[model samples]
Every structure is written in structure tokens, then in C-alpha cells.
Target: MSDRKPINDAMDHMNGIEGYPTNVDLKSLPKPLRYFGYFFISFFVLFFITFFVLSMIL
Candidate 1:
């Protein structure tokens, strides 16, 4: 039973598509500004959600 389990798991992984995009493509932006751009966008989204919730509660 244990030996059959390993073969089943290996086959499952091999059956899927490989080499997919798993991270952000930072090189498309200017080097020094990429971090700031990501940070600014994330902060704006978080701030908007917080403000929206506060407004609804008050």
C-alpha cells in the first residue's frame, strides 16, 4: 500500500502544466521605482477598504 502511494503522487504532479508565472514581473518598470509603485498601490487599496468600512459603520 505505501509503495503504491508514492507512484500515485508522482503521476499526479507530472500530469499538470509546468513553468507558469508565479511572481510579479518587476523588470517592466524603472528599477528604482518598482518597489515604490507596488507599495503605493497596495497602501491605496488597504486605505480605501478601511475608509469604506468606517464610513459604513458611522
Candidate 2:
């Protein structure tokens, strides 16, 4: 007898856990949070670029 059903029907959230947010909605966030996200992403880009440029120069 098959007793197991689908773990998650939609499987949209993380690990198919209900009510677990998988992502941050940038459009829904307030202005400050949106800017912070942009800044956080830019920091990574600049950090890698700086290291690469320095390695090439040295």
C-alpha cells in the first residue's frame, strides 16, 4: 500500500518547507533595504576586481 504522498506540491520554498522564504523580494523591500542589497552586491564585485587588478600589477 502506497502511503507516502508528495513532500511539497509547489516546491517553491527552501527545502520544500512550507512558509520558508526562499528569496528576498527586492521590489517589495523598503528603499533602505533595496539600497543595502545593491551595496552588498557591489562590495563583492569591487572586492574581486581590486584583488585581480592588484595581482596583475604585482
Candidate 3:
């Protein structure tokens, strides 16, 4: 019994057409996760804007 990987492993790198194999597909997430991601991003942006405006006004 051999523990070594086959030579076909080298051909697997062709799957990444974007030139980067580590790219993350955020759109493929589930429904709840998409909502959570949108909420989190909007929350941070709104929070930053509110604080910035308050600081300028005060």
C-alpha cells in the first residue's frame, strides 16, 4: 500500500479561472447568511457615518 498522492493533483490547479485559487464566493452563501452579511456591513457603514457626522456637528 502506497501513501503518496497521484500525479493528477497538479491538474486541479486549472479550476481557478480568476488566477487566484483562494478566492471566496460570498454570493453562494445561504439565505440567512446573506441577510446577516448585508446587515453586518450596513451596520458598520451606518455606525461610522453617524459618529463622523456627530463629531463634525458637535
Query: All models: lDDT?
Result: 0.71, 0.73, 0.72
TM-score between model 2 and native: 0.59
Cα lDDT tens digits for candidate 2, 1-58:
1233446755544334544444556599899988999999999999999999999999
Q: Write the per-residue lDDT of candidate 3 for residues 1-58, one digit (tens) a residue.
A: 2333345755444433324324568888899999998999999999999999999999
Q: Using Cα atoms with residue i matched to residue i, what is each candidate's TM-score against the true structure?
A: 0.46, 0.59, 0.58
How does candidate 1 fare on TM-score? 0.46
Worst 10 residues of 3 by lDDT: 12-21
Model 1: per-residue lDDT, tens digit, 1-58? 1223325765646644352344557687786698898889999999999999999999
The list of candidate 1 runs beyond 4 A from truth reads: 1-26
Candidate scoring better on TM-score of 1 and 3: 3
**Which residue pairs come into collision in candidate 2?**
none
Candidate 3 lands at a TM-score of 0.58
Clashes of each: 0, 0, 0
